[model samples]
Target: MKNSQLYIITLVVLTFLGCKELEPRRPKEHSTTNFYKEVIEQNKKLNALETKRIKQTLDRDTLTTYQSSANGFWYTYINKDTVSSQTPIKGDIVTVKYNVTGLQGNQFYDYQTRDYTVDKEDFVPGLTEGIKLMKKGETITFVIPSYRAYGVTGDGSRIGINQTLRSTLTLIEIKKPNNETK
Candidate 1:
């Protein structure tokens, strides 16, 4: 009887241990919500710092008056075509000669001439809007923020990540769409 009782107790203990509740395995890492929130906060801080730096640069420049664009960039005309009222429309092909420089005026790209179909081609985001603001024979120097210029990933060549750019653009010609006669 003693042996049977001891065996029964051991069996009961083993059964209980073996029937332990199974739980779903959880990841050791943090939740995605927390990670996204951290990314947003970091981006906010970066944007603020970049904006402050841009403002400081603008403050020091007394030679040119920069006009703030509604699209979140600043521009000053190098050569304004006051006589011509026409600007590039959505489908108009525009020929431009432009050069890119850093905020401190270090050249990233030399003067290159390219023809772009306005609002229809892949070009610099800020400059796309900047082009529409120009008439033929107008030259404008645009100060673009990093987010509007290249965002986190840059042009993958000379421009680095989160680098703001100053581009001097000359609108060489604005060719109207074939549907519209000159």
Candidate 2:
């Protein structure tokens, strides 16, 4: 009787221990919200630093007065078209002669003329908007931030990653589309 009672007590203890509730194991560090917040904060810091550097470079140039654009870039008219106020519209074929340089005055590309359909073809985002602000025979110098120009990945050959650029663009001509009347 004593042995049987001992065996029954052991079985009861084992059953009680095994009946304890089971729970799912949770990871200690699984939240992505904190990681994304850190990324955003780092990007803001980077943008602020880049803006400061660009402002310093602009301040050193006394020969030209830079005007900030609504699209997050800066520009100055090298040769303003005072007579004809017409600028290129969307779908207009525009011929432009341009040269690209770094903020430190390092030339990436020499002056070259090319034709593009405004807002239709793929081009530098800043230059595309700047070209809309130009008229035929007018030249303008644009100081573009990296985000507005090339972002992170650059043009592969000349412009490096996240490099600010200074480009002088001359509107050679603007050919309006055939469907539109002059």
Candidate 3:
């Protein structure tokens, strides 16, 4: 009877130990609000520095004048054909010859010889909005802030954290979707 009692106690202790190991550990902090606030503050500081850098670059350039939109991106036409024509709206398939570079003049991606569709959500918000302000066969250069470009996380390769981007886009074609598809 004493041997059986010892065996039962050992079994119970082993079972409790196994259950404790199986349980998930809880984090010290339940809320990530402070972490998110820190990220936002960092982004804001980086964005301010980038904006100043872009403005300085523009000021030193004697070749072209830059302009800003309500969406907070700077743009200037390299070559413009028509300004009175219709701009590309939503559901418009646009082909653009483009080049993208960082604020420090490091080239990231370029497709000068090819064409890409202009989906509303596919491209960065700044590029999309910049394209909408251009007519067909027009070339425009623009500066996209970090928030509007890749944001804090970036594109994961050439673009780094909180990096602003500069792009030159030439709108080659614009094909609006039909009413049935819309």
Candidate 3 residue 74 C-alpha distance from true site, Å: 0.6
Residue 124, model 1: lDDT of: 87
- Candidate 2 residue-wise lDDT, 18-98, digit = tens: 999999998798669989999899988998999999999999999989999999999999899789988888899899999
Supply the TM-score for candidate 2. Answer: 0.83
Between prediction 1 and prediction 2, the one with superior TM-score is 1
Residue ranges of candidate 2 with Cα displaced over 4 Å:
1-21, 27-29, 179-182
Best by TM-score: 1
Please give the range of 10 consecutive residues that has the lowest summed lDDT in model 3.
173-182
Better of 1 and 3 by lDDT: 1
Give every collision pair in model 3. Answer: none
lDDT of 1 by residue, 1-182 (tens): 99999999999999999999988998798789998999999998998899899989998999989999999789999999889889999999889999999999999999999999999999989999999999989999999999899988999999999999999999998888784522
Q: What is each predicted model's overall lDDT from 0 to 1? A: 0.92, 0.92, 0.81
How many backbone clashes are present in model 2?
0
TM-score of each: 0.87, 0.83, 0.71
Q: How much is 128 displaced in model 1, in angstroms?
A: 0.6
**lDDT per residue, candidate 3, 77-170, as tens digits?**
8888764577787778777889889876799986664543555457777998898888888999889988888887999888887778889889
Which regions of candidate 1 fall more than 4 Å away from where they truly are? Answer: 1-10, 23-31, 179-182
